[model samples]
Target: MLITNQLGQVLVQHVDYRDTCLLPGGAADKGESPAHSAGRELREELGVTVPLDRCLAVDWVSPDSVSVPAATRFPGEILHVFDGGTWDDARISDIRLPRSEITAIDFAEPAQLPDLLSPPDARRALSALRARLNSAGTVVLENGCPLAPGVLDRIGVLQTDRPSYRYPWHPGPAPHDRTVTQVWGWLFAPDGRVMVLLEPDTAVDILPGGTPEEQDQGDPVATLRRETAEEAAARFTNPLLLGHVTDPASRRGYLRYAAALTEVGPAQPDPATGHTYTRILATPEQAAELFDWGPATAHQLSAVHQARRQLGLPRAARLPVTELTDPITC
Candidate 1:
């Protein structure tokens, strides 16, 4: 049998079982069980031994005179089915094929299974296995190839489960005023560019600033300098706090600020300490289209920067906010 992964990629195998294509297994030896015989036959036939984990079925073939049942191999023979270890081998070797009895060995999606067996048995031998593969993040391709990096989609569990994203917040009376820890000066070039960072499946498009820690001996401006160098690896020659938004219920708000500074050096990719992304710059519209941004932030950016012309501002500095968390490098 040419075993394959959830994906339809075929691995090394012996025969296609003379076109019958049910999982190949023979009769048991003197004292060994049917399943034991199956395990042995699997190894001998495919040259790759699999430790049987569970018995899948015991198909007892018979000749029903009432209505001729579907033709089956091992007629009057007991078909013992078993599941085994994962098929991880990429190639098959030392294969001994009997061409006169078996022509080829190939893996395929269940929809392309042979038409010899009864529908139910075929489902057990193929369809059910395909479903299991899909749930295991094993995609069976048309060319009998199984894609690697096995991962089951969350949607499978969600089919019978419901979940939601939530922000854990304290449930208490709203405070009168929240403390402002740090104010960051975000500087952007004039070419409608901005800095952003990314990680898999999650993104954050924000300025290079944070709140002052208790250990910090200086003010919020000093904190911004420290955070910028620490997080973005860029030195700030000039930073100015612009405005402040206070929310009593919220833990803290920012003293929003902006300034003009040179991004004179290479913007290193996120060191991946946390989910990190490099700085990016684009027009409001371009930023939204190029990267995944939250609706509120995208709208604000779009309103402020219109094709690089902010009506009357003599020298304003702003950049697009974006983040990429995909695993592959951009």
Candidate 2:
């Protein structure tokens, strides 16, 4: 058992057992809060009555992880993580490490901690917490130990204030409509160019898209096909499936599917409904330059572009973050 401060550094006790390694305070009396018990135990065992602030975690030796007495009922050790404490290395010299049972004490730096002992989730929280301390004005956010989702690419980047597919910031049960669906399309024109429509209110130039009908199937491929026929009055021969992206609106809760197609000719107005479209033909090179395919979309295009280029195949488009071989671009 090891107690770590808010910075994730272990508080070591110098004991007879070699005195270099540190161990956390063990067990708790009945009706004692984990944080309070740790403070009391420190006072009783070593006379260091350091006031604790928060119970960061409970380190219980799982039955599978360690050996423990079956009869003893304990919460193991509580990691009372804290900042603004007055205790220093000099005062610890007078403290007592009881010889009757447990022995020794010493402080351990964070880098020495094994990854196995500190889970990824725990390490992420600890890392973020430590980074905040280097900047005194930072707000230390409690990570709450979120579980990593199983599918897809590892989350290498982080956006603190960005929207999620679900309400990550406001986490709790809430009413949501399942009927709303996302519709996206790839409308190609005659001269190896594609139609890109800019949203009237926004600066984004994306493919024409709309919401799906209530009774329409939730499949994105079907929805994109429908939007193409209805909104642009264009026919697509073969629409290849691309990877999906989580909607930025709700992050974890919403999803959007992507697909591409090649066609020849301009989009026309729907004769049956008198519906017209706002469409313009643009080359893929122009698209890569004019439109930010979005970081999520950029990652997808990068992967696809890399694969095709490596195999020496004809590429459909250049990626937005494509490496520049020239000195000026870099």
Candidate 3:
């Protein structure tokens, strides 16, 4: 069974027998359906009664495909993963693990699965997460690899660890006492999808703005324009300052903006990294999920959408995020 918390972190278990972490579940008893077994395992292992109504994925492993202890040639097995629903502090506090089998449990980020689990397990967990996000019901996998993957799968979303920053957003004027060192914008396209730049090294999603260069002459809009052009080969109009946040670590203000994308030029390497970014357009909600801003994501996204409406842009359709391979050419 695949369980998660409100923040989308997977609830994983640690056992004495296995070095890697495991999602909560065990083999099904005879005459028991997969869903029933999942519920039963939760009761026996964690002493919880989480409903297992949603089937997220089904995986089939081939014989001798993966090695395991106490087996010369590993036999094949069919695995069914069900949703255990999101748990809160009260529900998590009630958990009672059978120490003889499951030793401990932790809520792990999706990107942390690779380090915590075996390759196949990591792949299966990530695929199941995408399946849950997708409109399609259940995903099928062979050797824990998705047979029909979506955009998120193809681009390897959640493959890298996200930065931990929960800076409080001040949706008002920038503090006159502090220096606004950085500027970032959610540049919206005519279709209402916002632009996000994928970092070359980490592939993490980020807005295409940066520190205000001296040449920018202390103009946040100027910084936004130059940064967007250099990072994404994109230009925008009608830059609207949403607000600013004071980074406790840096003691500098980070400005936020909402603008309408005007034109996209050919892709070029960013001067800083000397590598071209993988740019994509996502709905404001989707962009919020890509960032690890905690609750502040909703606040920024709300402001972005409101700015979008003010700019006379339509709400983006609910679809998979789109990769802009070459915005001008594509």
State each model's CA lDDT, in order: 0.42, 0.40, 0.83
How many steric clashes between backbone atoms does each model show?
Answer: 26, 21, 0
lDDT of 2 by residue, 1-330 (tens): 234342234455544543234344545678987667767777767766666664333223333332347665334432333332423456656677666544655444444433323343234334333322222222222232213221000121111211212211111211254333454443333333345543322223446555655445655556666666665554554444333444345542222332334332354554444554444444444443333233344454454344333433454432111211111200
- Candidate whose lDDT is highest: 3
The TM-score between candidate 1 and the true structure equals 0.34
lDDT of 3 by residue, 243-284 (tens): 887788777888999988888887799997797888888888
Candidate ranking under TM-score, highest first, comes to 3, 1, 2
RMSD to true structure for each model, in Å: 20.8, 20.9, 2.8
> Model 1, range 29-105, lDDT digits (tens) per residue?
99998767877777655555666655533444444411344554334555454555345334344445544444545
Candidate 3 deviant stretches above 4 angstroms: 51-53, 69-75, 133-137, 326-330
Best by TM-score: 3
Overall local distance difference test of candidate 3: 0.83
Q: Model 2 segments beyond 4 Å from truth?
A: 1-180, 186-193, 199-204, 252-275, 288-294, 303-330
Better of 1 and 2 by lDDT: 1
